[model samples]
Target: MAPRRYCRARLGGQSRWFLDRGDHLLDLQSAVDGDDVPALLRHLADTDVTWAPPGGAVQVDPARVEWQVPVPRPGKVICLGLNYAAHAAEGGNAPPEYPALFLRAATSLIAHDAPLIRPRASDRLDFEAELAVVIGRRARHLDAAQALSAVAGYACFNDGTLRDYQRRTSQWTVGKNFDGTGAFGPWLVPAADLPPGATGLSIESRLNGQVMQRDNTGHMMVSVTQALVLLSEVFTLEPGDVIAMGTPAGVGYARTPPVFMKAGDRIEVEIEGLGVLANTVEDET
Candidate 1:
């Protein structure tokens, strides 16, 4: 069977499962084995990508449902820092000999069309456009050859950060974990649908319709395969886990005057082929 885009959503207080099949959404809940993304990924891996869609599944109206992060509860939301050479230099640092990594609480994640909150503590909310990988199976000590097989799919991520909070200490967890800052999803494109490691794709971050950061996935200092191989070496990767590959240069804090996202501005992170993840900025109330 051919690969398809998928998502989890809610409509009128009811959570729903949907598979994008071009013209309309096929309600996966109506399928013989109705389940969410994690379950679907598990089934695919065990069965070799053979999925039979619901024969009489209802067609869902996209306008009626609210998008949710494709991976509902990733045990590990691992993020990379300074993965791009230009991004590293912009921050006045040299590319590291090893990947700089951080963790984000699942509480920080927000769905597409949701508001990216600027916490009451600071207005330095910034955008970092990234490509996130969703792990499909349990993996430990993955080798270079096993990296691609462990991946479930790819999605767009806006690592909305509070610069001041991030720098207040050496660690970035506090600044990065403010509720509703991580904007993820709209859809997930299967790993089989793209080139190895999801490379060669154009990734961009735009603020209020103006492009702020743009680059190719190929520019990443630590390739996706490498990150997975390296990450698994230290920790076991589980199904539904997310690995945010890091952003390119042009982050607000590195600018001459440093522009930041404020209330009422629309921020969009787009990864070619995967789809766009867009959200409005709002102040913490």
Candidate 2:
């Protein structure tokens, strides 16, 4: 069976789960809480509910509902850096033997179509298009072969960064964690719906409607399965934990004439199977 697509949205000031049933958006939040992916999947499996037409089940217009990050408050947001060989080379560095890992706070992320704030502290705001893996089951110390089973779905992610701050230190935490910089969602596509590990899909990023970065998932130096297995070696990977499988080449900072995001600019990250995540840039007040 093909997997279903799900989204977390704010309707009438309340966050809810929405099922994309092709013709209509079903309000799954009314049936089950949006927090548990595995539980929601089970509920969907057992239910025989039919999708309601637009404004049938939920009277609110989807456009009126404010979008929220698919996983609003994940326990951990693990990001991979230099996971693509081309990206590493573009940055003037060689591929590392192990994945360069980093952490992003939930506070740093905003939902699709929301504004991504360019911090007042820096003008070097850059965009990174990445594939986000959402963990459905708890996993610890699993091998590469068993790691992919723990993933529930995939989503598009923009690992927005403050380049100047990011280069100030060896640690990337501060530059990568600017509040409301990370743009995630649009929706989550179930793993079974796409090729294993989301490989072979075209992943690209656009700035103000112009293509800025383009690549394929198959080009990742560190594959999703390997990332999960490697990460689990340090600590347990719990449900709701996210792994951003890193960005590709053609980043703004790597260009001959660097191009960074500024206020009023729109940025979008699109993955072939996962859908598009679009956000506008706003200056921090």
Q: After superposition, how far is residue 170 of candidate 1 from its true place, in Å?
A: 1.2
Candidate topping TM-score:
1
lDDT of 2: 0.85
Q: What residue pairs clash in candidate 1, if any at all?
A: none
| Per-residue accuracy of model 1 over 128-153 as CA lDDT, tens digit each | 99999999999999889878899988
Best by lDDT: 1
Q: Cα-based RMSD of the predictions, in order?
A: 2.0, 3.0
lDDT of each: 0.87, 0.85
Q: Poorest 10 consecutive residues of model 1 by lDDT?
A: 43-52
TM per candidate: 0.94, 0.92
Pick out the ten consecutive residues of candidate 2 with the lowest summed lDDT.
42-51
Candidate 2 segments exceeding 4 Å error? 1-3, 35-38, 41-60
